[model samples]
Target: MPSILGGDIDPSSWSIIQVDLSQLNIQFLILCGVAGIDLAVEVMPDWSELPYDLLVLVSRCFNLIEDFLNFGIACKSWHSVATKHNFNSELPRIPWLMLAEEEEGNSFRKIFSLSNGMILNKRIPKASRKRCMESMGWLFTVGEDDGETSLLHPFSGVQIELPHQYTTVDYYDH
Candidate 1:
């Protein structure tokens, strides 16, 4: 009979064996001795400490923004790579559908993705207590009672105040 590592061995002496990678210390040494393999044990790598360029390369493989955001939360180094705005995936980003506000004074809003049927709860305090409309990737908001108007970039948390609804001239009234 032929041994698994090569050369001939007695079939009567052979037996089934199972090795676990996680508990590969003493058992691994014993296996190497049996197989005539002279090798040293090596330590596993810490994934969080991977090289910066390698992490960036891995980050670029994620086409979904949700997956990319989750990857950033894995470790500080990964977060740095994710926040660098360097994603260059060939695939386009999936558009998210912003659901209506749940209740008054709620800081979170539910966003749905059509591609994967995913729902993400995003914290958007600026849209609270306002009537919001999506236009050109910006949230056009108007205050319910104060009649205040503004344009908000939901993801970046940027808010630009516009003139009050009553202050703007009615072009249709000409």
Candidate 2:
């Protein structure tokens, strides 16, 4: 006799039973109708309907570049909320080295983040080609041709114009 999963349910152990498909469907429908009646059914919240304050608070909790970036890209509402505020607060992110490869005097920059160990090679033709300073998780850069200073957030690709340089500061040496 053939056994199923070491069980004694062989051909002789059980009798063949037939089921009516339509009758079973009807019974299932009736059960559903009875259970779904007059219970003030609860529905899951939509993505946009999530609380704004809660999202901002949760966004501030993440410190890693990858983790924070992933949180912002999760949904449209999340992205909007994250960009509108300083989600990381005063918490310092992992320092990343932005080293420009000197190729024909116009080179691409390699950003290596210490937080998640992500190496990004980017070409910024629109902005500065050389790094000026790296302090407190921000990169200050000066354009080669225009000498315009700009601040960049390495992981997020966010750049902002810096005020005019008042004094000359040596970037290479102390």
Candidate 3:
């Protein structure tokens, strides 16, 4: 009699088993029961090894930007899927409210997601002491002292300079 795992067991009694990956835990229990093995054994799947197509499919299921970004941080392969252009465009866009800065000089800003009630703390030093408004998906920021204006993309930290506020207006004397 050969042992499966150093235990006195007959291999002939065991039959081939098919498992569904989605229901892995339940099917694993059934396999253990059929094989007369201990139920205490634990099995953990390597999520990073998931197929690229499957990972992409899972990435699309995220409606919130915060959740979508966290999915990319899971592993390198998942990061690849998240960085793809317009990978999440199919998902619904939820409005995110940018809260006031915690302190005058602090670089961190709190953003609240209306869709999921999640708050994200983002460090945007460029936005410090600037009046910000959302136009489309970018932040239109105006400098407090100089009255300069620029567009800032909060997530990507990309900034685009626009003509200064003075250039857009002409002073008229009556």
Candidate 4:
């Protein structure tokens, strides 16, 4: 609605419309508010003046663009400013592997970015996961061949096998 943020609203009905705030939409709305700078540009139709006081008021309370997004849901005034912020910044990084006490019980199957700690993937590539554990720069025997073992990557089709025991450990040099 055109009367989203600052519309000289007399009734609180305008405020009630901010019930379902999607995060992406809210961010866009904040960015828009920043772009619509003249309060005169708002009130005068083809010449609404940018509400500097309102923008300042909103910006001060909205420490982050995300905060302005949340405010946009409250009323039309906030919606303008909320939609004006930028979305150039990066989000948090996700985890790479998630393990649990049981194979199918409460699990922690997610990889967050090592840079930002945002949740990334929720799977472990059996072949490469061992490599992550081996990131310490040491090769160790993982599973002994009591039965058939399949080494595989979860996201890719790469695989390997260690079928029989070797007589000498010098077969392959690290």
Candidate 5:
């Protein structure tokens, strides 16, 4: 009783909905929901105390499931759930190339992957939300005048110079 009262709030009592929640990382969601402190008071019904309410928990599970999907798409942790079938289907059959971004209104830029029409690179982690929409949404490319294009992450404001002039660990890291 003391453990339940003083320990972290836990929603593990609820089970996965058993639906096609492949888009939602159920395991990761459970971990997130368990982080807050325990409830201040436990409600009672029919003059009986319930350790946990199953109905509310089920609802919370559904909500968390939605969050999990968004979380996966926004981050790199469970991105597999988003592109799990890319290589196994028609997504990998046709290939496209990344072209250079042209004039103000021109759209001739970046290679689109054959798989899912992406840049042949996985989605950028949500941590780098401002890094580049084109990072994953569009394929990066080198064109005739594509000299050392700066990879400026709008979020961190970190600019990684493309077409590096020097070979170092930082260049290889990205």
Candidate 6:
């Protein structure tokens, strides 16, 4: 009986049921009935096949910036659609503020978006034991001993090192 189903079903299970779908028509009918009654068994559509314009429209309709960001990050296809659209202008006017707290030799930074009331925790690598300054979406980290300055984007994870002798205060002043 399992050989008839092309080895997809176990012979032991066939013995338990005492019946096998002996015909293709009977199998088709059973499958159609099961599909109609079972929503969980429904096939998922390919998100990559969705139109770019439609995805952008849906992404821009999100109320929260975090949700919008997450929608874009859901897949590479979705991200490509998001990057091509000017959805950032549609986001709420949120001022992102960086708040830092130091505890037990570790520094924790929280970025709060005033418009959406979303607080995001930002991780700064290699700057945990250093003096850090946050302003205008940029983190300026200064090494305690070497006094080296590095410009970091906490959320985007992009870091650039300045000249070894560069002063953060002087750089910011200019």
Off by over 4 Å in 6: 1-50, 58-64, 70-80, 83-92, 116-118, 166-174
If scored against the real structure, what TM-score would every candidate get?
Answer: 0.57, 0.49, 0.60, 0.24, 0.19, 0.49
CA shift of 6, model 1, Å:
34
Task: Give lDDT per model, in order.
Answer: 0.85, 0.68, 0.82, 0.44, 0.39, 0.70
Off by over 4 Å in 2: 1-49, 126-131, 136-174
Q: Who wins the TM-score comparison?
A: 3
**For candidate 1, lDDT tens digit of each residue in 50-115?**
999999899998888778889999889989999647666576877889999998999899999988
Clashing pairs in 2: none
Q: Identify the leading candidate in terms of lDDT.
A: 1
Give one digit per residue, the lDDT tens place, for model 2 in 1-174. 557568666563354322456668788889879888554578877866579888778888887747778878878988877763545767765667776555645546777777677888776543345546776766788766667788876556688888755445764364
Please give the distance, in angstroms, between residue 41's alpha carbon in candidate 3 and its true position after superposition.
Answer: 15
Clashes of each: 0, 0, 0, 45, 6, 0
Residues 33-146, candidate 6: write the lDDT tens digits: 988855356688997778888877787776655666788788887887665354656455556877655563565666788876777776655566667787666778878787
Comparison by TM-score, 2 against 4, better one: 2
Per-prediction CA RMSD (Å)? 11.8, 11.5, 11.0, 20.1, 24.0, 11.4
Give the poorly placed runs of model 3, Cα more than 4 Å off: 1-51, 73-77, 169-174
Regions of candidate 4 where Cα sits further than 4 Å from its true position: 1-108, 124-132, 135-141, 144-151, 163-174
Candidate 4: TM-score? Answer: 0.24
Off by over 4 Å in 1: 1-51, 73-77, 89-91, 104-107, 171-174
In terms of TM-score, which candidate is stronger, 1 or 3? 3
lDDT tens digits by residue: candidate 4, 34-152: 89744345444421234856564545554344455675666565455555443223333223433322333222245434434565444443433232232222222233333334444
